[model samples]
Target: MTSYYDQRGVGLIEVMVAILLLSIAVLGFSALQMRAINATDESLVRTKSLTLVRNLSEIMRAYPNAYVTGSATSFTTASPTATGAVSTVQAVMSSSATSTVTVDAKTIDITTSANGCLSTGTKQETVDSIVKTVPAQHCNMSQLAARDTLMAKKIAKDEDISMTVVTCPGTTTQAIQTQMCVIAAWNDTKAILSDSDANACATSNGVYKTDSHCLISEAY
Candidate 1:
């Protein structure tokens, strides 16, 4: 004869097994949710990086001379002493030359023949003198491309981003037709995304990288 106590004992064992299975299912669902959140964060970062790279490209287009004329030079100040005076300084700097001057407690990098002024330590208002009154008849596209590449690196540095600009054929020879590739890379520890091209940017431990290419024609 089946005893009532035996029946109750069997029921308890079945309930325990069901509860254990539910716990495992809940843990799996939680892990999946966490992964989704990580993926979303990675996507946002990648989108921002792409926007920055594109912004740089547009800036290059606007200041073709600054990028194309390898003639631009830069210099650092000998010693910058802070002055209580607060005023804007304007100077005409020549291309391929660098001048460092102290202005209003800030050290300013004045690049002659280029657009804009860079300040170190503290921000200062500066008005740059336009060096070129007339445009050049011919520009060395290769040199300009190289200059643009350097500018991209500087702009992306604040975000811990890495950038590379490469002209096709990898030569300094001036050409009327060439393609320029801009690559941006950043560390993505989660390894949620893949790079656009294996050689476009360096990758380690789940780094995400992308590249943008544009064709330039310098017709005489």
Candidate 2:
């Protein structure tokens, strides 16, 4: 016959084991949740990078800069600065007194001074009929390239990522054309600049680093 004292603390041992198992399960769930969150954040950054890289590419094309016409790969590290978020206003940016233009993806009423430039004076109205003060970047020839880089810089800053518009060093002189590489790096300790000897995000030779959290998109 077993004594009651012999079974004393046996139930306590079982309870302790159960508590440990529960703790382990809770820890595992928390880890999984954290992993999911990190993955989601990475995905979001990548998506933004894609849009922004393409956006910069279009801006470069619209501006027709030296990189597009040089026919030889060159390095450009001009990180322009600007004030607010850039609207996705993909317009021809013409200057006219009374005309309609797109603002933040919405067509709006545009009016400017007789000189026909936003730098002089401009007005913008949204489609909702609510008149808000926003200038149209039209006919700013001297600042077109500046504005392009500024837009790229501001958007990248807002997205909490580092980026640049550098030449995608063409390897072959015949088949490979002089291309611009839009590089974006996230969770990186420093800006993703061209490093000829280091394994970087889109190396100086246009090779992308596999172990780094970076992306490279070509725009020619």
Error of 2 at 38 (Å): 0.7
Residue pairs in collision within model 1:
67-144, 68-144, 71-96, 72-96, 73-96, 75-98, 93-112, 94-112
TM-score of each: 0.47, 0.60
Spell out the clash pairs found in candidate 2.
none
Model 1: lDDT to the true structure = 0.39
Q: Give the worst 10-residue stretch by lDDT in candidate 2.
A: 68-77
- Residue-wise C-alpha lDDT for candidate 1, range 1-220, written one tens digit per residue: 4686567678778899999999999999999999999789767766766876576556445443322211223322211122221001101111222243322222333244332242123323333754433333122332333333444445555666654433423434332222444455566321122244454343332233453221121111
* Model 2 bad stretches (over 4 Å): 65-142, 171-177, 189-199
Error of 2 at 2 (Å): 3.5
Model 1: runs farther than 4 Å from truth?
Answer: 67-155, 168-177, 188-220
At residue 82, give the lDDT of candidate 2.
Answer: 24
